[model samples]
Target: MRADAQKNRDHLLAVAGTAIAEQGVEVSLRDIARRADVGLATLLRHFPTREALLDALLRTSFDELTARAGELETSSAPDEALVSWLRDCVVWTTEYRGVTVLMAAAIEDPDSALHASCVTLRSAGARLLARAQAAGTARGDIDGSDVFALVAMLAWLGDQPSLAPRAERLFGVVASALLTSAGGS
Candidate 1:
């Protein structure tokens, strides 16, 4: 890409990130172009599709989240690290109003542009869950899929207008239930 073209793409990505963060993923591409002071054709040339744009916009954050999980695995206790990362995942997935739904769908669809990032995100949490289970802090029977489902469920709950306020507390309860000690004899 030429210097001007690269500048336009960078500006578009930054503007789109702010717009989507403020207005949700449903914000119009035309509006993004307008906000970035770029023509619609320029935006299209940079990102051929909405998913492509989204994939570009979210890829960095997803990578950061995955990296954070690895850092937490080394820096925190197994269960604490898992729970902390899970909480962070909830926040990441629900940052934009409609993003949780997008992530949930993308995680299951290999054809989606966001699929690889979503898989990486899930794998990060799975690694933490595996560590916790191995340490006997989390339930032995629960696997990475279970942890992924819990994160997805929490993200879904957060997307609900009525349930959004209760999401954190609900997450706490669910996280507690996933602990080995929570299942008292």
Candidate 2:
């Protein structure tokens, strides 16, 4: 990509991220282009589709989450690290309205542009989960996919206006249930 094209793409991604964060994922792409002072054609040229644009916008957040998981793996106890990273995953997935639903679908769609990133995000959680299981802090039966599903469910709850208030408490309950030590053993 040329310098100017790369600059345009970066600016569009920034504007789109803010727009989606503030207005939900349904924000108009044309409006985003206008806000970025770029033509709709140019935006399409860069992103190709709404999912592509979203994939680009969210890729950085996923990468950061993965990196944070790596950091927590060393800095915290296995259980604490898994819990902390799962909490962060919820926050990341729920950053934009409706994003949780998009992610739920994207993670299952091998052709989605966001699939690889989502997989990486889940793998990060999986690493922590494996460590916790090894330490006997978490349930031995649960795997990374289960952890990912739980995070996605929490995020879905976060996206619901009526359920938002209880999401944190629910997360705590679910987290406790998944922890082996919480069984009073």
True-structure lDDT of candidate 1: 0.88
Question: Which segments of model 2 are wrong by more than 4 Å?
Answer: 182-185
**Could you tell me which residue pairs clash in candidate 1?**
none
**Candidate 2 per-residue C-alpha lDDT over 1-185 given as tens digits, one digit per residue, 9 for 90 to 100:** 89988988899998998899888888999999998898999999999999999999999999999999999999998888998898998987788877877777889999999999989988999999899888888999889989989988999899888999999999899888778974321
lDDT of 1 at 102: 85
Give the TM-score (vs. native) of candidate 2. 0.92
lDDT of each: 0.88, 0.89
Q: For residues 119-168, write the lDDT of model 1, one tens digit per residue.
A: 99889988988888888888888877778788778988988889989998
Q: Give the RMSD in angstroms, all C-alphas superposed, for model 2.
A: 2.1
Residue 32 lDDT (model 1): 99
